[model samples]
Target: MMEKAYAKINLILDIVGKRPDGYHELKSLMIPIDFYDELYFEPSDQVELISNVDIHNNAILKTVQLIKDTYHIQRGVKITLNKRIPLGAGLAGGSADISATIRGLNRLWGLNLPNRALTQLANALGSDTLFCLYNQRAVIYGRGDQISILPPGKPIQNITLVCPNIPVLTKDVFGVFEKAVAHDFEIVYNTYLVTKKESLLYNDLLEPAFKVSPKLKDIYNHLVSLGLKPHLSGSGSTCFLFDLTEDQKNLLKNIDDVTIIDTQEHQ
Candidate 1:
């Protein structure tokens, strides 16, 4: 079985507060993009993974073990991961892969588990994993596990994703993050629904991410100096902009040691 794990961007991310569990309460509008990683699964006696890049502290294996223990299935899986999404780009690549594993293993093992059951498994991983399981536009709340899947809004177009070589760990950013006054997400939410534009889009993590990696701040400044309005995806080193002109695209090509992906919101 093969699964495609899609990448995502946060159109609106607001950190509401820190919880007693050391997790932050947040509200966000997240959407998937065309960028993805591919995973192919086959039956095996022991769980195994082969990826183009070496993975340390892999969540894929953890997910495999969870499934085996929960279902008491003796069979194992060999997963071949074709990684495309850059790690630590605020793209939730890791969580997406974990969610993909859940879906792939369900079919591979013939568990016939419903979405709710799959969601239960995903919840153990993280809130991002839960969103990736559905891979749709939603208003994510409460540490990201509470999802309000929205009706298909206006499709986002002309997306240019700039992924820097720098990897900004989410934890590190959040460690330095200070809670900010919450935005009324309803306004941002309703405005996007009506206008199909992100004129009011914002990400609270940008400040902390910049603090975590000053070099990333430099990149953001450079993009801004080029007359581009770039938005940070999550706890990001990667930044994205919409509707770039050919000249603007050419200007972006001059940046060193960055991957530029031309994509759009996945419909």
Candidate 2:
């Protein structure tokens, strides 16, 4: 089976608190965008993973191993990952790949596992992995394992993501954030309850991300100068501009060191 792993953008991300285990508690509104990476799976005598990028420590390989060990299945599968999502852009590219693998293997191996079972495995792999399994807009909380799917509000259309070539590691961003001032969750929660307006979208990690990558601020400022409202997606180097006019789109097309992707939800 072939599966497409869709990238996601965070509409709003607020850090609630830190846990005793050192993981940060978070509340985020995330939507799966149209950009994707493709994975192909075929039955094999032994597990094999192929990718242009490094595979030895790839999330997809880790997921494959986890499934075999947990299920005690001797069956192996060959996986081909054609990656499109940029790494370390806070796009959840790796998480999406693992989600796709788990979903595809469930059917290819005829495991017949329930969604809850798959979600359990996904949560173990990564916090964002569970959300990727659903491939829908959701408000995620508690280290990203807890998810509440949002009712279909308005479909997000005409989103343009400007991913600077620089990659910002999630851990690094959080590390800086630990020392930085945090946002008020009460305010964030109330805002989310009231509306999904693009103007209200915010990310608490932006300040720390700017600290980690100074150039990110320049990009943010540049977008603002162009009369565009750009917000960081997750702990990101990728900033999103929503509802861009045709002229603004043309202006972005001329910019350098940035990759642009249009938003499309997975069918």
Candidate 3:
């Protein structure tokens, strides 16, 4: 069986509060993009993970183990990952991979688990994994486990994603943000009612992301100097510009240490 794990971008991310368990409460509008990583699975006696990227602390491994232990399934599977999405770019690549694995294995093993059961299992993997299972635009809240699916809004066309070479850890970004200020939840539910073009877009982690890697601010400024309105995707490193002209796309192609991804093609 083959599954595609699509990447995602946070259109608007805001910190609501902190939970007693030390997890931060979050409210955000998240959408899946065309960019994806592919996972191939086949039945085997022993579970195995094959990938070019580093497998240490890999979410896929954890997901497989969790499934086996949770269900008491002795069957094993061989999984191969064809990695296209860049790692550590705040694009939820790892989360997507785990979600895909859960969904794929459920079918492969004939588990026939209900969506609610799958969602519950996904939540145990990571904050963003449950959202990935839906693979559509939605409002995510309560540490990203509670999801409310939205009707398809105005499509965000011609998006150009620029992923910087620098690596930014999500935990590091959140650590800096927590120390800087206390964020109060705004009436952001209204923002989701508008079209993608008309919605007020923002990321609360932007300032702290800059603190984590000052070079990201430099990249943002450079893109602005080119007469482009670029916003950080989620946490850091990857910035996206919407409705770019062909000339602008060509110009951005010349920049070093950057990858240009078009979301329209994926749509």
Candidate 4:
């Protein structure tokens, strides 16, 4: 079976608090994108995993092991992965792939689990994994596990994502928020209302991220200079320009050493 794992972006994000478990509570409107990673699964006599990337912390293999350990099924499986989503871009690529694996393996093994059960398991893999299981626009809270179906709001603009070959640590991003704990619930909730208001919806992480990677500031400043208001996606590294026409897209294509991905709200 071949399955495609999609990417996600935080339309609006805020840090609510840090849980006792050390996980940060967040309020964010998350939307899935068409960017994907491919996974191929086949029934095997023994459980095994192989991948294109080295995968030192192999989520696919770990997911298979986790399912067996949790569900205690004696099924054999094999997974082959084709990774396209840029790593550490806050795009939830690994989580998406794991969700797809769970879905595909459940089907291949005749597990017949419901979406709710699958979501529960997805959470075990990662907080974002559950959203990928549902794979839709959602109001995300509680470590990204408490997901609520959002109103089918009017679609936003076409997006162009450019990852500046730098990895921004999500934990560090949340940690920064934890220490500061800006009481800007106004900024937090405005974006959730899903209107055309632009200013408050932007991420406050930009200041800290620019401090860490001046190159990120360089990329962001360039996008802004082009008359496009871009926001840092999730934690960092991947910045996006919204609502570009074909001519604008061609203009961005002229830039050197940029990874441009054409994206829209996943319908």
Could you list the CA RMSD of all candidates, in the order they appear? 1.0, 1.9, 2.1, 2.3
Cα lDDT listed for each candidate: 0.91, 0.86, 0.84, 0.79
- Name the better of 1 and 3 by lDDT: 1
- What's model 2's lDDT at 261? 79
Q: Give the top-scoring candidate (lDDT).
A: 1
In model 1, which regions exceed 4 Å deviation? none
Alpha-carbon runs more than 4 Å astray in model 3: 178-189, 195-199, 265-267
Please, what are the lDDT tens digits per residue for candidate 3 over residues 94-200?
A: 89999999988998899999998999999999999988987988889999999988877666777789999888888898888854444343455454455344336
Better of 1 and 2 by TM-score: 1
Mark the regions of model 2 whose C-alpha exceeds 4 Å error after superposition. 178-195
Q: Clashing residue pairs, candidate 4? A: none
The TM-scores, one per candidate, come to 0.97, 0.94, 0.93, 0.90
Best by TM-score: 1
Give the worst 10-residue stretch by lDDT in candidate 4.
178-187
Q: Which ranges in model 4 have alpha carbons more than 4 Å from their true place?
A: 178-194
lDDT of 2 by residue, 152-214 (tens): 566677888899988899999999885345666557645765675667677889999998998
Task: Indicate the worst ten consecutive residues by lDDT in candidate 1.
Answer: 190-199
lDDT of 1: 0.91
